[model samples]
Target: MFDLVYNTIFFASYSNFYGLGNITLGLFDVILAYIVTIIVSILVALVLKVPLLPSKPYRYSFDVSAIYPTPIIAIGILSIFLVLNYTFMYNGIVLAVVIGILSALFVKYLFDFVFPKPLDADEGEDM
Candidate 1:
């Protein structure tokens, strides 16, 4: 469900002349988009709060699989746009911001999945 929303926003933004010809947008517009996406992702994480892994005392196991989805999705989508146009002429700042937001959201979801509360734990339990 979250993936759908995230991908939809990404596709919609890209469809709006994302990596086409030399189009220029204001800095503030780019910044606003980044901020909005980041905030939305954070809110989603807070609301879900699903721990993906168990917390341990000074012992750790990392789930690397959880770390790569969003960037892969973003890069794959951007690569398609760039390949289709044969140019990387989109707004750099905007792209960076978008990628950052996507990356953050992806990581948040990853952590939630990787560090989830124990099975015996009740809802609202803190780790």
Candidate 2:
């Protein structure tokens, strides 16, 4: 009984079975890609001097920073690539690093231009 349960659960957990061709990625590899992308993005953002956190009391602030958008951008882009089956290297470590670097740069330089903040005067009117 225990063996039956274990084998059933293991069926869908691997990229391929003993005699079948590989299709989906192993769970560990996809998770590793996400983790690496997030770490690299945060590190690059810190090195670039993007603020580590949002503005003070920023429950509603529009400010983009290292912790807020850097990882998010990196993970989001990585997801798109993964969905398209475009991991540039086996296990996707290289793709993760490249996405992380580009995301940090985009947040540091192009973010404000692409997503301009509203006028400060009325920013907190609702509060």
Candidate 3:
């Protein structure tokens, strides 16, 4: 049941974009698409006014911000498509861009809700 729904969505998405699978695409192109997704996601996040880095004491901060989480999300999603052999139009260029944009927006708006900040910070509880 799970595989049926998974294949239906992933394969249907690729077929709609006329994806011919990785046969027509080289490893380099696939790699480039992942890189593009990362770059575009970061760029969009920056444009959305996300800080380039976390706040002071960055090492311990639990904050989720653009430069870090945005690209991470984009590449992760792109990897899913790659692993599923579901490259979309333009050798995944279009898919990468879409992923990048959506990831940035998600990080900017929805990440906090998904991963709420630690509320006991002032209590100095070791994490």
Candidate 4:
């Protein structure tokens, strides 16, 4: 979990360091980061059979179609960059890539605080 947070911070900072020569590219990177985070979070949720750390119920009602798109787009972009950079650095070990993916999941949970889809709309309304 710590590793995911650390790597996400590193990835964000690294992306920022590349300078803002291309607005399109910058947007792409942001979207990619978001997507990577979401996908990893979902996978972690399934694998762990629990919400990742820092879980908090969402404010809005559930909408499966609406839920997934943003993260997918974000991850797709960030992944392209991670692959380009990490491949050169680590020589493509599967373990390293898996770690990177896990790290992405960790960051998603850390920053976003996603909880399981609520069973009742009124479940946490008192809070």
The lDDT per prediction is 0.43, 0.79, 0.77, 0.43
- 89, model 4: CA deviation in Å? 7.9
Q: What TM-score would candidate 4 get against the native?
A: 0.27
Query: Higher TM-score: candidate 1 or 2?
Result: 2
- Give the Cα error of residue 70 in candidate 4, in Å: 15
TM-score ranking, best first: 2, 3, 1, 4
lDDT of 3 at 105: 92
The Cα error of candidate 3 at residue 29, in Å, is: 0.8
Model 2 residue 116 CA deviation (Å) reads: 0.8
Which candidate leads the pack in lDDT?
A: 2
Winner on lDDT (2 vs 4): 2
lDDT over C-alpha atoms for residue 85 of model 4: 43
CA deviation > 4 Å runs, candidate 3: 1-22, 121-127
Q: What is residue 27's positional error in candidate 3, in angstroms?
A: 1.2
Q: Write the per-residue lDDT of candidate 4 for residues 22-88, one digit (tens) a residue.
A: 3222344433444445655456545544333322344452433223433444355445555334322
TM-score of 2: 0.76
lDDT per residue, candidate 1, 1-127, as tens digits? 4353344345545555545333433445444444544444444434445233434432443332222333444444444433233222344335544554555566665545765635433455556
Is 3 or 4 the stronger prediction by lDDT? 3
- Model 1 clash pairs are 51-116, 52-112, 52-113, 52-114, 52-115, 52-116, 53-114, 53-115, 53-116
Query: How far in Å is the alpha carbon of 46 misplaced in model 2?
Result: 0.1
